[model samples]
Target: MADQTRRVHFVLSTHWDREWYMTFQQFRYRLVKLMDRILEGWNTGELQGPMQTDGQAVLLEDYLEVRPERRAEIEQRAREGKLVIGPWYAMPDEFLVSGESLVRNLRLGREVARQFGGTPSCAGFTCDIFGHNSQLPQIYAGFDQAAALIWRGVNTWDKRTLPWEGADGTVMPAFRFGLSGYCTYAHKVRGRPGSPESSDPDWVRRQIDDQLAWDAECTDTDAILFFDGCDHNEWDPLSYRILAERFEEESGGFEVVHTDLDAFVKEMAAQADRIQTRVVGELREPAEHSLMRDNQWLIPGVMSSRVWIKQDNAACEKLLTRHAEPLGALSNYLLNREYPSGLLNVAWRWLLKNHPHDSICGCSIDQVHEDMKFRFSQCRGIGEVITSDTLLRLAANVGEPVEADSTRVLLWNGALTPVDGSVEVTLQIPADWPTFNEFFGFELKPGFRIYDAEGN
Candidate 1:
């Protein structure tokens, strides 16, 4: 990952967000329509030169949005080291993408990557949460990715003023931008709300000129990421190549290149002792028993969010925690191959991305009824959960407390058992309850309480 002179990097971070595309049946319609469009474009060969590489439509899987057979085809491409529309998970934000759900997403994404030919080392947020967290060194390490870019944190930095991390460990690539300045060009532009079909080459060229002027005028380094429109659906092979073509026709001798975003980090890593690190982590302190404070965003860093987003993310985290067990069961069942592959595929696709039948959200009349039956089959039919719960109950019996003693108290706290656990406790619990879910039925002694923790 050493630096090459005048690096021209190209990266395509693609994603799909459509209302009707989550359900199975509707997805079918989308798939057919898109497939027809691609095939037609292929036949006409309207796609030429770099367009073949850039213009080629990719089905980015924030969720595995396809049928099993199509997934197989993608896998085939992956095995051959071909990069055809990789990444197949919803990428539910990593910090709180539910451990079980994240695990499942990774497992499924891995399968899809294997079938396609290239394991997707790079991940795309499409502008959800902010920052490339330090905790994610392990995440990228897991996916064989050395780094990722934060499209959101373009000019936001502190201290070093280059693309350096703040007090938190949010990494951005600002120095690279400073060196390049605005070698790229464009024109005849009008800025809209957020770049919705307005900026012509003239406008872009003007921006480039301003960038050049800014570059010449400034003595110290000023950082800026050239590519705009990170959150919107502006970045595709079509738009990128169009820009490239413009540069080719207009920029005369300036070189343009394409590279995966990670390439930037890897290249930078070669020169310095370490790529500068910092990002916003804890903006506010977590006061005792205060949920709001625990998740607040105070410090400005790479993933800086207005108050609203942090609150929404916190809420999502709570929801994920509340449903951890069922989530774990779903993951384990799928990983263990507890049922037929197709049935598991149907279930997770429904949960994570789109439906297996037609490729949309919410089942059709036919699918809804069928899905109700299928879910029951996936959950209850396999009996993994039921059997596992039964084992938990039986196993606790052998480890019974050695004759309840005043000195050797079993430390009775909250519910001795949750539905997800083997042990259950009585109706009422003691003073020092260790927070847990209570279920029906239980037996308790006069002084001794039954209520215990979830896995009690």
Candidate 2:
């Protein structure tokens, strides 16, 4: 109250889910069209952008997949810091995936962002995730990420910003924009920027003043945030341009800035001493703010909506982690065989594509789930092939013992400890056994034959 009218940082962002109601390619094509214009604005200096594009590196891969021609332009935008992306391969459901998978997701995101002369946004932008895990502070801090921008799963009492403490005692700034989510400001504005109602300077001033005053009560810091875009929103250069100009002209004592998550976090952190800090870890927050709930309607019924999809997803995860990756690594280490890293990366990406909160939560449309099934099939197929091939290569080197009409197949347990369990062996006319089929005093079925371990 003693100082100036707080600085309002307008963060423009689009929460682009790679696939939710539609297929990945379908959504990606629209993203390409959106980026084309957003980048064009950057190149022409028409839009002063710090527009955040959903913090997922996978979108860049998606955009480049269809429009390889615009690689240079896109790279330039990234270099210029006009387009902020990554810190995640895909915005994942924290509860669904393994902790290791989350680490890999962030690692790949940082790597991808580095390729285009831009670092991943320093803020962990978990804007739309249903909730967050406690380990996130440690994970984000591992990558040197300084803060988190959260929308969902925020406690109204926390007042949007909290000092998120990890299991390891690592602390990071966490900003929460709740109630109406990240695009609350955009919703408050009447129609498009050029509309008669939206163009009024006095009206715009009142809205800003009211929002700032309301937000001011929520925190001790003089910095307030206004997110300018919504879900799957296209980058409207004209609207942003008009608003940017209007805010500058009639900010009503507040310093208006078009910023990204990183800059905003830094600004907030700079005045960290003045702002209240609540040490937090797991941020499921109150049930009231849960995206899984909307008033009396419990929306997270989708968690159990499609049991079969979840079952298949579990199977695929086990196949990749327990079998495929281990076998591939062993084969590369022991046999000097080329590890199928590319195949594994493709498989992991396919898996991550379905890890979006809506997609993996089974809350999407039938068509989207159908596409997810296809992606799951592709990932599982590749993983199976890698595991089977590695097993075959390793098995080939084992010595076989001969016993009369039967052949002994030696089993090599890949694990370090001695295995004392029953093993299923497929007999295919053992090395020394001359006969194709033999029964162990049991009747042979029409299509099945039983062979004794000992030749008879």
Candidate 3:
């Protein structure tokens, strides 16, 4: 027998990657099957849930895209609060994408969760990202999230619960799942923790005691959090009952309950002084090689792998932010017209799908990166069209004249003040038209030359 005050919360969650090494279609088949099993078991009283996802709304979106008929059942489960989802469109690689994109991801996630009759969990779930950035607290706080459940980038000296601070002096609770990661305490019974081969009375008592002892060493709180799932894990719907019954049999010193990150954060907050509070920002440690011992992985080099993808991603981001959005807004304001929000969203979703750590890092299978290249192409193509259309409309309204054998172009400075820049024009001449050598009185260069729009 131990102290009466000790308690433990078993968090049942899956760190779901919508697509990583596997293609989205391949994963969606498994996802549909898994959700069907989970819902059926719960409806028939075979599964107990408070199950949480990796704070991703994109998985549900992908699932609904394929199986719109099951929307009612999924929505019902979400309303019951048995299914936890969102607070993120996808679990993004923070540093690889822009800070603004991070905010938009959360915004879309929350919107999707509400559409499904579910309130997005208030916890920031950052389980699988290779590392975290300094402004994460601000981003999460902007969404009104209370805490973050993180797996990587914690030192041995750091406590399980620490205060994470952002650049703007915002602070929030952060939970690190140790070097072993989220599924640390899971037993090998049914691929989920807290389940065993034998639920015999003696085995139950021993298991509880061992767990309690291990729990004590990890944190100062009497409550222990055992994350029960891993990447792409589909839960055994009936396993929660097995854990509940076994814990009930050996109910001597502690209580066990299936809970979520939100509940755990609230419980810990009730006894705030017990959790060590220290300001933390951008954390990158316990390198990829080190995590291999614990059966976990995080490759930092993915940030630079497949340099072409990274370059394209940066160009797409710039084209949208610098050119399309500003030009669209200016056209809308001056001409009383609307920008193509639907097409813009379609383009954004395509890009965001490629933001997952493994996909963006170019560390996944060849097929996944190949698909990413295609998605990047689509994103850029859409952005370029939007920018081109907006610019054309604005130019037409400028009422510039077309002189003989020459064209007039109007270029607006999208910035606050005038900017000094160069514009290059390429001309394709017909057989009857003047040759470059004849026109310029010299031999033509191989390619187009850069010059000022003013013909300098």
CA error at residue 402 for candidate 2, angstroms? 9.0
Candidate 1: residue 57 Cα off by (Å): 14
By TM-score, highest first, what's the ranking?
Answer: 3, 2, 1
Candidate 3: how large is its RMSD?
A: 4.4
lDDT of 1 by residue, 1-456 (tens): 222223333343323333222443454455455443443443465422111111112343422354444555444434443343323354444443344555556567656555455645343222322222334434434555433333222333222223333333544332322221111221112244347444355555555456434432331222212333221132333344454554333242223444443344455444434334433432122212232212222223312322333343333333333332343454455444232345445445445442121122122344443443443344333334433443343334434443433112132222235445454533344445444433753643244433333325
lDDT of 2 by residue, 1-456 (tens): 436756777787788887787877788778887877777776688777577868788888888888888888778778888778789988888877778778878888887887877868887888777777889888888888878877555555437677777777888888877456666566555345567767676676566566666666776566777777677776655446555774654355577778787887887877766657575677765456444322112244656778787788778787888788888888889889998999998898888787888888888778888888888999999989998778877766444444354333445464546888888876565343333335674643333344444332
| TM-score against truth, every candidate | 0.48, 0.84, 0.85
Candidates in order: C-alpha RMSD to true structure? 12.0, 4.6, 4.4
Q: By lDDT, who's the top model here?
A: 2
Error of 2 at 369 (Å): 0.3
Native-to-model Cα distance after best TM-score fit, residue 241 in candidate 1, in Å: 5.6
Residue-level error in angstroms, candidate 1, position 5: 4.9
10 residues in a row with least lDDT, candidate 1? 48-57
Q: How accurate locally, in lDDT, is each candidate?
A: 0.36, 0.73, 0.72
